[model samples]
Target: METKKHALLSASSSHKWLNHGPIALLEAMVPEEESSEAAEQGTAAHAMAEHFLKLKLNQASVLEDSIYHDEDMERYCQDYANFVVEHKESLGENTLLFIEQRLDFSPYVPEGFGTGDAVLISDKILHLIDFKYGRYYVNPENNTQLLLYALGALNLVDSIYDIEEVRMTIYQPRIGNVSTWTMDTGPILEWANGELKVKAMQAYKGEGNLEYGDWLGMTKIKAISKDRAKHHLELRKYQLREAHLLNDEEMAEVLSHVDDLVRWGKDVKEFAQKQAVENDKHYPGFKLVEGRSSRRYVNVKSVEQRAAEQGIQDIYQHSLLPLTKLESKLGKEKFHDIFGDLITKPLGEPTLVSESDGRPEIVKHDVNADFK
Candidate 1:
């Protein structure tokens, strides 16, 4: 039997288990969600990046697929490969680079292991670069996932090289985020001995109680523990029903849980739909039905011919080519030379978020100030 992708104590999900160690035990009972198209695309992107970084040019260009292959993917993967190679070269000829390196960190976390996208070991520093193809910007500061990968890489190479520090990079080219963080091996080992080992043990033996928080955002815990999610959200409704108004602090407290509750509700609905469609799983009071469909011409060329016969010479749509398509055709230099002056970006509508969110808080303004 194969080891499950949702390892009880996987490095990728250290953030979740570290948040609440007992959630892993609860998570094991829940079936894994089917991979989404976005995830499949990310896999394809990673494969492309790996090929470019590990193979010669003749071999790298063979990733031909209509479904996920496109100009943007090729460009991004090439950029990632270039970044990794250039960085490795900067470290000198003695630096060894490994692609898709499997690492084990069981010394710290019981049964903990994961694959690092790329790892470079030099004289004193071991740099681990992870290629993130998703649009979500991953920061490298104190990220438990990256920290765990760093530990695993150090464990793999420390015996061979005298590594002093572990440096990790998160390259998310889709959002143009290349974030890096570094820590000395001594502190990393200290953390591994302290918080990491404690959480891993607690999670492995199923020893802690599940609590409600934003960590629920990770594993769709709502599917298995719908009652718990509902109960947690019930406080918001109970507070709303009370015959008194909430002040700033109380409202803020209630608002904190609303986002997670909404996400959980949506996940539950979608999970049921996927189960029904993919696995033939049935849900009471929720029969699957076809959605409304739109009509389209089956033979567009025949339709064009028929329209032309009816004296409809202009029975066609005309619109400017998308900026990206035009740019690719004209090349970046020519495209910018001609249309750079014509582009404008309007301010986006404001969105509410947690105080801990990295984006700068939106400043308030008065409508009358512009006229004044």
Candidate 2:
């Protein structure tokens, strides 16, 4: 028997491959991307949360500190801890807690696995909590990623514990959104056995309706492939064919389709550029261009010494006001009373924006009308 080294269908990326099977095969071939700074911070926050929970669970005397501590992260972790405390009574006496626990759902999906940030197994209910440091709102209900994690958790403790129901919670404390979804083990398992299984098998085989969807993972992979390029070429041909004046309704219809095509084109181009930079590959008639650089003082002391020798004591000093800090020092009302008269609205450069954008639309006015 050949043992699989990696999970073909990871729970975190279930949203993508499930919707479009070919993305799974494509991602399996491509090199993994480097984590962004925000992702790194989120990892650190998770570590801090786990450490804090461990101390709390053990009833330790002193508090352990984290070097990667941030004010927002600390506040978020505290919120998660508080939630656990609130539900402690319902959790029962034989409550078992786990942090960053690896969960396997191999029976449901082929080599499917995920890590739960916090798992609490009790008599009849299992509570799975996930901490999201991202700014986007994450609803626990109908969230494929969290549901997959729930399945993984069930696989781990369903046999050992009398878990009839599961509670899935998403804590996005930065946004002050705590969403919870509770369901019986029957429905969850049913989903796993049904849609999840079909998709996983189809994705694993790399054969199915492989089309782009709203899922970011699917979009990102498709954006860097020849499939997207072919679509782009077809779109351009159609665009030229329909480049004519139209009625208001026709214009709206055209824009509805054109907007999506334009966005996809932009995203695909950007992805290709990033891939080129990473792999040291070049497109014909185009080469990698170095980003603009700025000079910085390596030795501040040496610069200061040189300035002092030149009889300039305040050479390194500049008079600049940090208005926001001053506003914080003074109350908002008081700050406004003092500086409100000086405030002015300047005309900004015009740009197109989607209707969904919350910013007030720029309304043009005729200066000639005032003269008239």
Candidate 3:
């Protein structure tokens, strides 16, 4: 497995830390977690893209061996490679292509560095392409990560190339999205010296106030994908269920839209609570009040010292952290790397779900099968 070095204020995580600088402090307490399967898959896709881009651009590159390749990955990666190289070709002979380029934006962001997927530079244009394998629709406009990458890329050839404008492109082939955001060199340098420097300092020191809904942030692509899936399933189910298969009770249960109802109920409750708590939004028939809480320690250290002074022996009990909390703290990759072969996910209790759910049904056992 290839290991990656992640800086405290890495460009990839610029979105999180930039929004609320103090999160960098909170994250420092937590170890790097094991990357989720999706993250690893994305890495594999990047490797594949690098392989193809190198081959297409006449640069020596090896196709990395990994378990994450699929038909979609191959197709998307090839297309992205083609897009990058083609864009370079269109820019003419003056354009130079750099793949998987190492970028250092530390002048603005302290100790900051990142890898640009593709950097095509001409005398007057510095084109930075970032390939996102995920389904999320990453907007190119004001994308902090891409902006930082563009800055880093510019720093590399700025003195040599009279790059008048920097064009940052987010090439997300999976979602058929190709977005570009452009900024003149003067404005970018101004932002770098002004906003970027301030934010980077705040992030470096982990000093800014926490942003509300940081944890609640969800990618637009996920929401889009879910809605699209639900729409298709809703339309398809009508055709599939032309004839009734269930009795009255079962039919009524299906008609209740239990899944949607449960989801909506939870969402509404959560949404209202967040609004009332965070924004002080006053909703009809609802008032903000402190909820019930079990007693714990105001300060664990203070309580411990007091207990010791009062001769309160055995005041502590030890137990392993819950898996979910541990996973969140350590990250999926680090957790798995440290505790490989020690963790297991047992079969969950089966429950009725809509046909649109991705999980496969458990095989049913027939008692009469042996007799046959």
Candidate 4:
């Protein structure tokens, strides 16, 4: 008898698939290697930091042309350094601010990631501050770049220090305002080990492929819209029936079709609106545009491979490796829900997902495995 190879099953149905529509479309439109190249060229902060750290001087220059002109940004950096130094005593001796420092997380990726204008590191507290020179309104509480730096720092210092709280700040110097979030290392680590690990596996397996009719493509969109329409119709009918419980049999029969009636009404309205737009010569036909946000899913193996290709040798030296068997046994839906909630919460809200609000009491460390 020949032995059959059993395929590994994912704990969460949502986990085995990518959810963000824009990323899915981009992945479909561009090849993986090409997308990676675009990502590398677009962001030179990592590269610049790596170069600056090699210098033996106490100061270095980092430039972002989009944020501000070179001279203006340099001036802003000087002002920020002075501000931190003026308030140095309040920030505490163990806390470091307005200093150019590189954190070594793993051997493959070194002190390449840079902290912005300031960092606060007390015995058990680590904070990252970014200075924005632009006039446009920005909510830094949920800023991804700040969070990435926090991740790098957490990986470096968590094991060495009894870190109690980690904070990230976005300082809009032009607006004279700041947004900040305090994070707990324990829950973040748990999320990394659980939900992030599953996402990583999916990315590594190249499961992002979706045909037109696949659930992740056009087919899923139509199916979901139809399902939502059906659900709304059913709910409306149930409410109407309950309201007219004493109606005659004929009236009840009419009421029974209320859901269908409402659905038809909505469909007619949509059809008319679309027709009007089509008839207008100046009007552009409806276009499905991808959103402007980026969705980051974990791909530990790919990340490891990329690191190795870049001559990174000490991946798991400082950081913990994926606890495969242990992670596999945990429920997938639970992990997705936990991470999803963290990602979807709006900025300034009293949730782990939004860290911009000045209030500090809302931070909680509960871990759930249930998918919602």
Candidate 5:
């Protein structure tokens, strides 16, 4: 039998659509492909991690080669395995580990389900570990996805095991982060019954207040809710008329609300472009054209040799220092050992961003004073 695919209110996107119920309806209208090539590669890496875990579990398994297989994947998987081994005591005696485990939280939601990367079940605690191969930091604290997974796993094993506290972990080895959030079963269930159930019903039925918020749940829908469309139009009009004329304080105040509209515009543009190419949708005046490309040396060794023969002193002109390329040349461990504490990342230039952006804001201690 084939497995069930993710529902519209899938646990992974609960953090978004749960916060803003209307996005679920909007998302249903537009066709969406898998997010990106990075998502596809993440899936492949997940399969690799599953295979590795199963092998360690004494199951018949074999390592498979995939386009996504690389040093990062290998390192991340190994680190995940190490975490599992190191946490054996916490898992209690005679613990069993499940890989690529399907968990269902449909009791609270209409069609809520998610797959956990690793589920360590024991008498005392149920550890729900998720592997994130992406460079972005995924915190486990107050993470709806992890909480949903924990709830589902608890529901599944409530009868069999005397599980008490649930440990939700996000293992992002690429960023050297392993965050764990623990909560007792009583509170987790309380949250599901209170906040999760209410929000989920609102999203599932698509009947709730429709207002633009700081949540990252905007979708590409031309004729969305009448109220929402009217508000967006007004905001756009306001932006065009008086945005540039605003003082610093006024600009900052306006930005908090206007950022959502700006992001929605970007989402709409992206959606139109994707639809035109992927589904061959026709636009009145726009035609799909080949994207711009840049020339690159196919064989760097040959190019270097030819350059040396031609007496070119600088084969690589206008080059910038890239840490990845440097690590590739010198080997990561060796490069780190040599440049230890010598290389430092400078403070990035301040830029306005939406509140939904997960990156920590640079809290400046020193500020330039000037007349307003």
Candidate 6:
């Protein structure tokens, strides 16, 4: 049994094989004591199964609510298990073949692999399908995991089937979508060899450290340069004062330079703030609206309302301002010109309502009324 640390430290190429096997291989890498504790508490998969059973029996509605514990994982496991149980017949035939059948491909490839999911062989073609439970978008066709399974199947059946093309499909039931991609073994193998060669070189150079060395080096350089510039500015100010002693022209020149510097600094600060707002609009988080309480689930509708209230005119009702329109109107420079004053103002507490307030007071102003 490989230790968890050792398993993780192994090459990324090995992940293809390890990930294809039972989840238990990775599970065993965890400490026995920890695994025992998890088993005693009821594994997340068990909880998910219980949840699904309840939903099926009671016809309960599952809400898109926040979860602090392992609810998400449990739900995913339950869904997959439910799918398997519900579609047993369609899946049973392929599942049996997957479990029992072994193909020989020594003629074309020296090594082969096995897959856990359903496999279909038809008309001199082989297809591999794997399901993912997560909500994030994953392109099924180009996925390396699916590709690895295809490669293994290709090796086993190529001799008997005369396989010309391999088709890999990733079925994401959570999102109700399937992505399929085809791969030609020859070109793929060549690309794989090239990537492996680069990995070997990186390993040899001791450049495989996971720590972000490039970012750290850049951060250090930036800090030192900023400190040097600050010191230089202070020294320059002192020298300017000394040189301006009894010299009116030099004093005027120094004052003008200082004014320009102050103006430039303000302009840069405004530009940066506007750029931040534009960037924030593109972030996925902006599409997620937080509930009044931290424990509550996020609501997309609330996010849309909040975004609209922020003066973001969504012409297409897409909840987000289109990038092209944003660039034309709310780009960094124009953003500050339009919203700088509003951005700088403090959001004061809301005024309290009293019984005497009755109907809300309305203030109306008109040039004709004033003139009359």
lDDT of 1 at 74: 82
Stretches of model 2 off by over 4 angstroms after superposition: 1-6, 59-68, 214-222, 230-234, 238-280, 289-291, 295-298, 317-372
Q: Is candidate 3 or candidate 4 better by TM-score?
A: 3
lDDT of 1 by residue, 1-372 (tens): 886565578877777778777778778877766789999999999988988886632344456564776677788888998999888989999998878888888899887889999899999989999999888778899998888888888889877998898899999998999989989999988999998888789989887656765656677566556555765656755455667888888778777777876777787788788889988998877799998999999999999888888988778789999988897777666888999999788888888889898889877889999998
Candidate 4 lDDT, tens digit per residue, 1-372? 752221122111222233322222233333222234433432433333323432322555554444212333333445555555544456576555435445432221211244344556667777776655546566655454455466667766666667777777766554667677777867656654665445445543544443332232222232224433454355444355454553576455555445445555565454445445655423266543454988774888899889989998866756543543223334345545555454353467443322333556654555673533
Q: How do all models score by TM-score?
A: 0.79, 0.77, 0.58, 0.37, 0.75, 0.33
Query: lDDT per prediction?
Result: 0.82, 0.74, 0.78, 0.47, 0.77, 0.46
Which tens-of-lDDT digit does each residue in 1-372 have in candidate 3?
A: 753477778888788788778666666664344588989989999999999888887778878688877656777888988999889988898788888888999899987889999999988999999999889789999888988998898889967998889899999887889999999989988998998899889988978876333132332221212332353245344454566566677566555455554454465576568667977899888898889989977999998899899989997789999986686567656788998688888889998775656789889999899899
Q: Which stretches of candidate 4 lie over 4 Å from their true place?
A: 1-75, 86-88, 97-117, 134-136, 142-144, 203-372
RMSD of candidate 4 to true structure, Å = 23.9
Segments in model 5 whose C-alpha atoms lie over 4 Å from true places: 217-232, 235-245, 253-265, 274-322, 328-331, 338-347, 350-372
Best by TM-score: 1
lDDT of 3 at 260: 50
Instruction: Return model 2's CA RMSD, one decimal.
Output: 5.7
Whichever of 2 and 6 has more TM-score, that candidate is 2
TM-score of 4: 0.37
Deviating ranges (above 4 Å) for candidate 1:
1-6, 55-66, 235-257, 275-290, 296-315, 321-337, 350-372
Best by lDDT: 1
Candidate 6: the clashing residue pairs are 141-181
Lowest lDDT 10-residue stretch of candidate 1: 55-64
Spell out the clash pairs found in candidate 3: 33-330, 33-331, 33-332, 33-333, 33-334, 34-331, 34-332, 34-333, 34-334, 35-333
